[model samples]
Target: MSFSGWGYVWTAVMPLAVLLYYFFRKKYKDQHVASTMFWQELMKEIKASPYLKKLQHHILLYLQLAALLICVFALLGPHLTSEALEGNEFIFVVDTSATMLAGEPAAFELQQELMKEMATQTGGKPVTIVTTGANPEIVLRKEPNREALETAIDRLAVTYENAKIEQTILFAETLIDDESTVIHVFTDALDRSILANKAGMAYEIHGIDQPLQNVSMRQFGLAKTEDGIRAIVQLVNETAEPVSGKVILTDGEVEKTANIQLEAEEELLVPFEQLPDSPVWQAVLQVKDDYTADNSMAAFVQEASTRVAVDSSLHELVGAGFRSLNVEVDLMDPMQLRKAGGSPLVTNQTDLLAGQMPILLIGRNDEKTHRVAGAIETVPHALFTYAPFDGIYISEIYPPFEEYETIATIDGEPLIQLSPEGDIAVLTDIQLTDWPLHPSFPLFLWSAIGELSGTDNFFGFFQPNEQRAVALASTRGEWEIYKDGEFFYSYIEGQGAFSAPQEPGIYEVVGEGKTLKMIVQLSNEEKTLVQGTSYRIGQAEETAETAELSIVPWLLFAVVFLLLVEWEVYRRGNAHR
Candidate 1:
């Protein structure tokens, strides 16, 4: 037994004071009796039952003492030690992924309630909370305050990204030490085998395993048409029953609706033709479903307005690539330009127009030829999105330039390089490389034109919580980002990167006098709400102080009962007298 507040032990003096008062209280004075015969009879009766008279005289004193003692015990805050409270350190791993929002009340909402209940019962034990999303975050660490724990649990929210549950669990395990810790995982889809394999860990999985029905837009794209543009949308029914709904495509001004029906687990492609040109278009799925994160998607379209002046020997190929993207191309002869003293925007003749315009230099200074030796390494950049350097044979290349950033390299030789001024320099001679024969050649030229002309006609699409470095045409000042027409975040010029919002919507980046639209959508994994399994691992070792059962209420109840008995005895004694 333990007492929380020992200061209340001084209250034990109350019972002693009551005993002293009973022994030294003022004595009653003898009064002259008018009826001597009745007095004499009462005295004879008292002598006949002396033991009963003594018991009646001391009963009130005993009752008063008992009540005082019990009150003191109650104030001391006594508690019984139990084995159930051994592992007082608790770790809560919460999954904040989008799938937790699939159910009616939402698995996340239920998890919050459960956490609050368990936390309240911890009796001021230390608790840690970890939330999982695109990245795992420790929100609360070893906090013993009940109010702080409740506040942290209430503040938890669901992210639209997929949860990294396995990683988060491993991270939580790192916090365990010599102390016995109990870990509770709250998630929507955790595999039972994961916990079962954790042999010596004391943990429990609280998972929500309900059948979820959902319909999602698998993909959305736009294609250039003779009149305007066409919208291609693919929809999927993720349920076991047939589903039908209307798909509404809108550009904030014009709205087009299409009704469609699908069998269970079916995918259908629906195209809308002759739609007027718009900067952005959105598609909304109007199906009754558990998961709504994937029901809506947005697409951004930008018309090509970049004009390229090509003077390279491969102008025919380059011009063909530019024209295909609806970009105007002006082809110029190298000899005619040299004779007329005309500067070329793009050329293999580096001496003709050096440092004059944003140029795409093909084989500028090839003084020496080096054969490819080992594996080729390419840096991640916007230029290599569709144009990878795989299977491209390079026999000769110019020496690496210190002023340019190398994009692709063979062994130690630079193959593709880009300057800070947006000039793309291909060190390898195109005649000696077979990259031009590949289908990615035109795509490479398209990227090059966009980079040189400082025009970004490409649309940016990303999954929720995804972050990437953004390359804008003007990299000069702070860029402001807006989501759904509201300001979201901002970043500086050189450090131009931003993370997608937790919700699915369209984001606009405004900077350097230009605006670009980016779309954040739900990934396929988030859309498919898989049922999870729950498991309990090893048990917590029993300890003497594992739990505490407070006896204050019981003690106080005894005090109340004793006081009532003392009051009744005093009232009866007075009435008899």
Candidate 2:
């Protein structure tokens, strides 16, 4: 407890008025007009004071004194120094996710305002500006200039992906000071999971006012169907009001627009009867709104005529082998396939023309067969091939064979080596002389086919030379790993994915002896410039806890206490009246 102005204690003199009132209070004696009994009682009741009247109303005197004491304290400017231990190092977390774009003026607007307020409150203390989203990034570290911080805040843009608040919080925690540090999080209330590890520091949450009206295209994809290409699009109307829009689809030349209406908080499913046969097309929702990013999307449809053309013998042999071994294959002849097809495949012309598949050309001795085989490869399928009879008297090599993968031979010759998706089991330049006569020929062929046909075994599960830790939750008591429908390994409950086979391939994870269905694919889009967002901080709500003592202003409480005492004193002085 302290006083801002000790000299103002002189103001305490005004409370002495209570003493003066006690001294000057009027005294009266009753005169007996007719009743002698009343006169004698009044004479006996008269009390004597040396220099003042006896205003011995204890409660009123105490109350008056208290009110005057309060006034003097207010005038003296008394203040309490709490001596709270606060960290000097500051971490400023700002949310920049797609959901922040909702509402009028947007939730990010409040984020901008908070950045300024935080700057003022921080009093030029060093601050690290952390942008939160799917990929939480640190824009500036330990910045002192408020202007520079404000500029960074205004320049911040919303991420298309959702924010990963938990990971960001963990990252910020790493930078917290051991002594005293504050973690100020500015965001629309996302999720509270991010608060799990906030043990060491103080946290100030600045929540944004977000608008609820929004319509978003949540999911969209194109899948091949028996009738034609099947297109599925999903939309969610997040707004309370009803929403209506036209879904515009275009495959460059051909365009189809469908009207759609979605109730608030409702999901709408739009299915295309016939998908466009173009290689590069776009799906757009023509809804009028401020946010245009989620309104439209671009897609690359696989080619139709493009295929992995195999010789009749190899096709029959490999197709039967794969079926027997449960290797999935879509077997069809290019010429015959087009004639019997119900709808065309491969619609995006810019990316891949119709009727094209990435080809895996095998041994073709004749020119006619070679042309037939080369035509199936897509024009730009990133080609690699090997020859069985290069030294033999074969007339013309195929034209597209110019763009093939090769290596220098021992004789300084360019021998084509096979490296399909980096699997080493298949060697490309197998000579015809070695095919029927070599001792290792049968083993080599079996290995080559197995390696070529088999997809990357460790693709979805593990990266090359990477040891990743994974925790899988299952309802069953036990879990198992499977590759190509064969059992690999099993583990007890609460066991991590570390002990499972490190080799990567599509692994079917089964729980409790029942197959838990999930598919993992090698994501080429993972390297794109845009990263996904994550939700870390959650919404704030009133909890069933007592009010914080720190929130009450002591000066205001003192003033109220004084007023109560003053009221008692005033009432006592007026007793005679």
Candidate 3:
């Protein structure tokens, strides 16, 4: 209990003085009466009331006095505090996660105890309630009203997601201005990664003392099949100690359980056999550990299909790669020709899509039908030329060309240049015909592959990035995709196929079937973890408080209102008599 308006204490004396004056005030009497006996009766009644009936007879008097007392108290606005209520600023963060629900007295119970501590230490200091979970929420902020602050604390609940402590800290940073603020955080220690980035503001950490030993179904995957279902389950040992657990797979009445052993920080994979054909299945990883939410994963499985196309010339290699990668690739011809039915390139048109144009033309003079041969000209897509291609041995040529510069003189010539008009021609002054048999055969292969394939200049085994779809089939009816243990996406029966249009990730198509796993190797930045190992707090501020009712004032008002009603009743009774 605390007072807000202590300066009004002297005004309280006025009400007391008024009460004293009323007590000693002189009264007038009427002489005429049916009998002095009746008057005597009244006097006797007053005396009896002084003994036992006094309170009952003069309830109105008590009411009037109460109203006056309440008004004085309200004007004084006095506040009382125990030794516990002496903090400058009360800052409390409550951990609201499923893990909090597991401990002895329960996480919420522990939070209540802490809340009491905060309430006691509040005195007249403003209190703030910060809720921690997947998304941090500010339940209260700098509210000097104690009852309202306590109600907000009581309303806090736990969530299935983990706490984002760093975000809460950042939020606190913005809430507080002076360093004198006392901040208290209450939570079960989750992944320290959440705290990797923080504003340097220091605060006290009150860990809800509990050791979490959990074995969760970290991942589950399924692939669609026409006749039966196939699935894969991964169990992770989230505990510090090595633990063994049983994994059960069931579709309603049917069930299968497998025993598994996992070292600390390691995981175990349990594959499911042909399961009964069903649209949905539930898998439970039963852990001997303390917590259970992290123990099981439920997924709905469904059937789907897809198609993947691959170029013909890369069949043997692509086939092997697909088998290793577990993706089906259909062989097809290259789409680089002028038309689907057109013959391959001729000598002057070595670039597959170059048409009849030369790559490069170098002369002070200009020629008709040729685009330009200078740096100023924008060359055609397939035509890249250079001046002086007279001596070079080009072996194993995919498209024969009439003009090519010798490899030995490339330093002095344009080498392989693009003409201003978009023609691909090499300088012809150097001499060396058997360049393919030279030590640069591999380098030549790289260059030839780049020219033949209409892909970007990156000459690797994998096709240059062109958006294309790939289909995967499974004996099971559903599947999940994961990259490095983190969930990406999933597919179920009737959903068709799970298509990835992005760069690359080492994907695990976990679920039913013999083909239980596949890896997608992406060399692009879109799929890479560019920021996982690093974090920075860009902005952190204490959250602003929403408009809320202050219970202290309301409670005081209720007491005042009741007193006033009693006072009105007393005055009316005195007048009627």
Candidate 4:
């Protein structure tokens, strides 16, 4: 509503003069019509007065007058004043982190609306856009054209990655020059980023201070049950009061629901019984909160069979323990296991290595006969998971005879050793320690089987940002990790490892006539929704909200379009005459 050239208002009077001339100008008289028959020929012979035409209810005069007024208005340009034109150069750090996806429009979604409003108010000013995804990116940098800017903004998407706002700010700092350039961040909070000691731009955090009520699905999995599979899910309520909701389990074909009630800040484990048969499973909470990204999750399940050959001599103890568990075990001839291929060999002697697949040599001698007095020192290994044997006694032990890796030791002697392929040999009978009777006995055996049997598919899931060794289903062929059915990375079957994707979702890998499904999910760290106070980096200054937006050019275009219409109307009217 403001004008840049108000002092030139006196010039608009020039168009009014033309309007006055059209209304009061003298008119031309018609020649005396001697005969009515000759009047038609006389109209074609005599030219109409160009300067003094009859103006009684004439359309041309009105059209001319309107065109003159438009010229006057175009001279006085007009445009709406908006708050976005505050800076000559702007750098926007928009947080697209998982926490922003909490409300009806999502904090990030509202942030996008705010950004669009700023763009509309840009008045053609340059803007640089930054997104805080897993990897900070400069979506649009110093863009001045409004159409192109809008296109870039439209392409922006919500990311399930953790907040990389600090990194994004670092990237944005490079775009800023002086104290006048403003950096506005739109996110759930300002302090959620690692901004305590980082040095950079003098930015203000424009975030939603209201804490969104969120119930998060921290983790979930499926365990074998007597009747069927049981779905185990860990949930937490981030609100100030107790929340009541249901957890739905689905396999794309069938569905089941389990209701949950949790107090504020309370963590609970809920299990759903009797799962249906499905390769793919999804767990979704029924809680309706501001944040819903963590409300639902997907997982894939794969099962494997384990076969072990236990010598007839130790069959009374070791063989009985294996049968007591659900896994398969054989007490027959060792040759049958060797020819069967891929099955592990469990014997009291190391010479059983003739088979070459994978071996677990359990010492045959009883520990009670040759008791060793020294306490053993064991290193951390997957076999020790849930199995604590720190003070267990070992009497007779066959120290590692080869250069294979030693897994554990007693005083200065090696107690157990293993090869890269999980060919392990316990120098003493496992029954010698309290581990067999311990609850971790089954877990220990399962761990050994998973490694030695080369289980094709992973049994569980991983957090998006977590890194661990991923075992391939087979060692004979190369394996490739894929995202959305396209190749992303490749891994050697022998090495059997690749970094997990940093975005929360499901992924798959294929090789050796088998496919493996894996789930990479967001960590617990991203579920926090508290906002942070605004701070600065280099120097602080006030923000601007107005810029020069003139509509004179657009107005002139309208004037030209109107004039074209006037010309067309006059031409058609004269032709009819």
Against the true structure, whose lDDT is highest? 1
RMSD in Å for all candidates: 11.6, 20.8, 15.9, 13.1
Which of candidates 3 and 4 is the stronger one according to lDDT? 4
Q: Indicate whether candidate 1 or candidate 3 has the larger lDDT.
A: 1
Error of 4 at 30 (Å): 2.9
What lDDT does candidate 1 reach at residue 396?
73
Q: What lDDT does the true structure give each of the candidates? A: 0.76, 0.50, 0.49, 0.69
- Model 3 RMSD in angstroms: 15.9
Prediction 3 global C-alpha lDDT: 0.49
Residue lDDT tens for model 3, 91-169: 6877665566554676567767777656755555687888874346788878887678777777777654445567776
lDDT for 153 (candidate 1): 91
lDDT of 4 by residue, 1-577 (tens): 7676666678788777876776567767668988888897777554454334444547766777777777777666666676554556788888777787777767776777778777777768688888885557888878888778878877887666777677777778777775667778888777634656645445567778665788899878776667877778889888899999899888767989877899989999988888865666888888878877788777655434456776665546676666666667777664454454556667765556655767777773323224465776766555664344665666666546567688677777777788665577777776566656665566556666666664445534666545454433343546677877778777664353456766666777777676777777776767666754554544435656565667787778877887898899889998999
Best by TM-score: 1
How do the candidates rank by lDDT, highest first?
1, 4, 2, 3
**Candidate 1 residue runs with Cα over 4 Å from true position:** 1-13, 19-71, 79-88, 193-197, 302-360, 365-459, 473-476, 494-497, 541-546, 549-577
**Clashing pairs in model 1?**
85-546, 85-547, 86-546
> lDDT, candidate 4, residue 574?
86
